[model samples]
Target: MALYGKLETEVEIKASAEKFHEILHQKLHHISNASSDKIKSCELHEGEWGKVGSILYFTYVHDGKVSVAKDLIEAVDEENNSFTWKVLEGDILEHYKSFRIRVKSIPKDEGSVIHFTLEYEKLHEGIPDSHSLLQLCADISKDIEAYLMGNNNEGSFIAKA
Candidate 1:
């Protein structure tokens, strides 16, 4: 088996694309409030919150386990409503030599469609693809959309931190 793998998933959201992008790129710290069960906390570790090359620390639940990740903001494209994050250190590093995630929200007629992509180089061929993680991304997207649309009771607290 190949050591490199990529996974992609998309979710249809009734929320505005710009608002969704702003939440992920600019106000990421508020994600914990929106998806309290999946993401425990997201905090800025170094540099600005939304700027490229900044570092962010995330404490989240995945596959029944609570894990921590330090990620670098690799790129942000406002025109495309997309951003890329490279994992610098985390539970993910244990299974993959390198991992990166890119997210983009495309505006549709009704609302928008959010896409998530995970690219990784595994330490070994035995390592499974990151399907579950991609699923988590989709779930989080739905949770955020619900919060943004005022359909979910989850907090929509956007932080300046």
Candidate 2:
């Protein structure tokens, strides 16, 4: 088994790609309010939002358990509509040597694809890939799309007059 692994999930979203990118890149603190059950709070510790070297402390629930994670904003590319964060401290470190999450918005003619990627170097080969974590990320992406489109549900956003 390999010591390193990568997991990905892609979902098409009706919400504006720019809006979605803004939330992840600059307005992550509001995520907890949008989905209080999954993410309790996301607070900045260092640097500015959408800037490199910023530290974010996240209180969240995953896999039926609550945990805290401190992550560093590794990269923010507005041109690509992407954000990358590397885990610095927290429960995730206990399982992996290194872990990072990157989200990119790929625009199409009509809607855009919200792509989530998890790259990790495990503490050992016995550990499985971060599939569950990827699923968690996908679910959160859906929640964000729902909140932005004012749908309040996972079903596709139907425009209102």
Candidate 3:
């Protein structure tokens, strides 16, 4: 049997939903660090940006190793300011049965709130809790906020793409 868990974190951004979502998709390589070492590259595999069924190919490293996987865009709702992706093929599949990320926006004055959620199913008991992964997502969110707010000196996992 597999264990399923989810973690979420919210980051306040001094930007609009459209701006945030666009940057998240186009510049993910810049904000992700905790997983950056694992990810060598990412490219659009199919569909349009932020569209359902859009695919992304990711080359990543695990345990000092590198591998690649293709992910499917499961959902994209611009009105709700949310998007989700499911890992269809990748090295992560060995330990994670499935992985998904969802981002939502909350309206606020001057700034907006970006809520990030990660869900996964562990293949075995040896898998660590999702805490680190959640933290990684949070870090990415913060980096994105800082970049949008003109504070580009924030720490990041990957260089600008």
User: Which 10 consecutive positions of candidate 1 have the poorest summed lDDT?
Assistant: 152-161
- In the range 27-108, model 3's lDDT, one tens digit per residue, is 5544343234445677887876556788888775545466777888898776777788888988778878888878887768
Model 3 misplacement above 4 A: 25-40, 60-69, 152-161
Query: RMSD (Cα, Å) of candidate 3?
Result: 5.0
C-alpha positional error of residue 26 in candidate 1 after TM-score superposition, expressed in Å: 0.4
Order of models, best TM-score first: 1, 2, 3
Deviation in Å, model 2, residue 89 alpha carbon: 0.5
Model 1 lDDT tens row, 46-154: 9998999999999999999999999999999999999999999999999999999999999999889999999999999889998889999999999898888776665
**Candidate 2 Cα lDDT to native:** 0.86
lDDT of each: 0.92, 0.86, 0.69
lDDT of 2 at 26: 81
lDDT of candidate 1 vs native? Answer: 0.92
Residue 70: error of model 1 in Å?
0.3
- On lDDT, the candidate that comes out on top is 1
lDDT, candidate 2, at 121: 96
Clashes of 2: 0
Model 2 Cα lDDT, one tens digit per residue, 31-142 = 8756778999999999987799999999999889999999999988899999899999999888899999999998877668999989999999788787888988888888
